[model samples]
Target chain A: DAGITQSPRYKITETGRQVTLMCHQTWSHSYMFWYRQDLGHGLRLIYYSAAADITDKGEVPDGYVVSRSKTENFPLTLESATRSQTSVYFCASSESFHSYNEQFFGPGTRLTVL
Target chain B: AQTVTQSQPEMSVQEAETVTLSCTYDTSESDYYLFWYKQPPSRQMILVIRQEAYKQQNATENRFSVNFQKAAKSFSLKISDSQLGDAAMYFCAYRRRVNTNAGKSTFGDGTTLTVKP
Candidate 1:
């Protein structure tokens, strides 16, 4: 009954439009992350939050914004969605930022920007 | 920055057969962690198995096992008695040790595994 969830499993928007992918975890984990899955390239981190109000950029963060107002939620927003940004977005959470701890992933959101 | 590499883009094995997926990484850090994550067609990232750099014994989970060669910097996943459910995209990942900045995961391109019935 308790696990990470992502909303709007599928989304479609026009170029230059704004879109947000939501991620929520019930475990109240201290660390949350957003990653985009591109073909041929595994998963690239977009952003990660260590705790509420504490966030940092990951490998690919140029076109994204993240805010952790609450410990359970870390949402990613694409200010101006481009076709290049049209990819499946995955949300993950971990107890600690340390590597030993495994990350739990959400179902993922498939975004399409026309 | 550390990098993960999965040279095999695709591989296949018959049911009940054994297969190995290759992964190599480059990292200057001595203490770290290595992981094998499986993504089925459902797209959920499942933790297959994990190995700590400090451990000499390899990690195993039922039908899954890993051959980790630290000096050669190679980690490969060996699945015995493969099943149809084993069909998925397998990714090799690395994470730096604690007390290090940028506590994030670096993943390889991924190897697509197909199970032949």
Candidate 2:
């Protein structure tokens, strides 16, 4: 309740369906990020927000969408789920964009697209 | 673009022993940061250690330490007095120091480390 949290710890959905994964943080950190972990690819960043209403794409951003309407919340949406989207999604928050600051991660959400 | 590589796919160390995991990166930027993250069975990503490219001395934390080689672009993690709890997937990551690209990190494929009791 005090740190970053991810909703729907596990999910399974059919391809072409719309799915949304929620991430919330209580620390009020200015920077929030979304990353997907895949075998042999490690954790690839999908999207990141420097502040509310400010988001940018990362290494792998295709088929994924993210929004930061509020500082404490950053949700990732799959416009049309594909089997290739099956992976563990992680949310991270940091106080600033400084390299010295460490990112705090949430309990990842494992989503399976069938 | 920067890339991080963890050469070892798997590694094992007897309890109370020491082990090192290797990592390499390709980058042209002069200022950046390196980090090692641990992900246990629970799937939580925990920061183990971090090193700054400008610093010549390696960073150490309790039983965990990093051998940072700026010229070679190598950052390796060493675990001493290993325990069962140390078993996890370790990731090496690199991040640019520039504010515009600071939050995005490039992570290696990760090495799964097993501790034998």
In the predicted model 2, the residue pairs found to clash are none
RMSD of each: 1.1, 0.8
Residue-level error in angstroms, candidate 2, position A108: 0.5
* DockQ, computed on Cα atoms, for candidate 1: 0.69
Clashing pairs in 1: none
**TM-scores of the candidates in the order shown:** 0.97, 0.98
lDDT of 1 by residue, A1-114 (tens): 599999989999999999989999999999898999987779999898889999998999998999999999998999999999989999999987676888999999999899
Q: How many angstroms is residue B22 displaced in model 2 relative to the true structure, after the best TM-score fit?
A: 0.3
lDDT of 2: 0.94
Residue A74 lDDT in model 2?
99
State the lDDT of candidate 2 residue by residue for A11-97, as single tens digits. 999999999999999999999999999865589999999999999999899999999889999999999999999999999999998
Q: Which regions of candidate 1 deviate over 4 angstroms? A: B100-103
Question: TM-score for the second chain in candidate 1?
Answer: 0.96
Best by DockQ: 2
Interface DockQ of each model: 0.69, 0.81
The lDDT values for all models are 0.92, 0.94
